[model samples]
Target: MDPDVAMWLGSTLLTIGALAVGVTVHLIGLGRVAPTFALGLPGRRLRTDAATFALTHRAATPLTWLAAAIAAVAAVGALAAGLGTGIGEWAVLAVLSAIVLVIGLTLATWRAHTALGDDALLDDSTNGPLRPGAD
Candidate 1:
């Protein structure tokens, strides 16, 4: 294969991979917290504090949005690179940065999810609205 074609293909694949990773991580993080917002019977609902749930949701929302933005930029860069009009170095840099951001955000979300679950079980009084009849 021609060197230029090889370079373009490699960079494009890298960017696409980064985008996929970011999106997958974001979805998994959101799913982890989804049970907290369930609308099932109070007895069946997951125990969680309202304040902590809100805080975690707030934190995760921004991170997910940021990941999406990074993915979008990387996708665009990849497309441009494939067209032979974009800088290969920039595409590679974008992919690397996106992967780093996604990893960091995933870790943070995991911590928040863990804390939310722990707090709910540890503090009986602050079970939020999920457990309506608990004494």
Candidate 2:
């Protein structure tokens, strides 16, 4: 493939993968933290399962942050590649799309964490929950 095409393709794939990972992390974090928050009153069992999953997976918060960082980096790389490529406006548009995805993911994660009042439910030691019968 041409160098420009290769750059555009690689950057686009990276951006897309980053966005997917970020979104997945966000959903997992949400499910773990406030599984019942938006589930309404019909899914008691699902809520319990979500809480259990959340407790068991204490790394969700950190993973979310990592995902967001990766997404941001990918977006930047995509933008740079787009500017350097001769693929015309489509490349720039793709870069802009990546930027938008990164921004949206960042904002959503921020809002969720803010609403929860905490990024993670981890204990002081970060080993697990502090209270007994927890996790």
Candidate 3:
């Protein structure tokens, strides 16, 4: 397996996993997108406070976007350079990128989670009349 292949594979896998989580969480509770994303991935319950959910969603939204971008770039880079290399090298890069992505992404999520409050307000408030009841 080429390094590029490995990189691409690694990136693809991570993105898929991350996006899958995103979609699943979104489906679980569209109204509580922020809290579900912050807590659900690790297995936690969503808070009932609308303000709290909005705060975290706003805070984490940027980081989450960045992480998604990073993952996409890393994957593309991996795929591009992996055309004719061994898996070992790609694996190394993949592992490193994965670590960084996870760390950075998790920090973003945590910040968003911690900053949430019962009265915080955000433009993209994840809480609204539609939140209380969902599929």
C-alpha lDDT values of all predictions: 0.49, 0.51, 0.53
Residue 55's lDDT within candidate 3 is 41
Candidate 3 TM-score, true structure as reference? 0.59
Q: Which pairs of residues have clashing backbones in candidate 3?
A: 2-85, 3-85, 4-82, 5-82
Worst 10 residues of 2 by lDDT: 38-47
Best by lDDT: 3
Tens digits of per-residue lDDT, candidate 1, 1-135, equal: 765566566656655665554555444334333433342112221234443443444335555556556665665565565466545665575566567556656755664565455644344565542332222
Regions more than 4 Å wrong, model 2: 32-49, 55-59, 78-135
Cα lDDT for residue 6, model 1? Answer: 62
TM-scores vs. true structure, each candidate: 0.40, 0.40, 0.59
Selected candidate, larger TM-score, 1 vs 3 = 3
- Please report how far candidate 2 places residue 45 from its true position, in Å: 18
Q: What is the lDDT of residue 52 in candidate 3?
A: 46
Model 2: per-residue Cα lDDT over 1-135, one tens digit each: 775666656666766676556655555544534555442222233235554334322334454456556665755565575666555644565566566555655654454434333535456677443331354
Total backbone collisions, model 3: 4
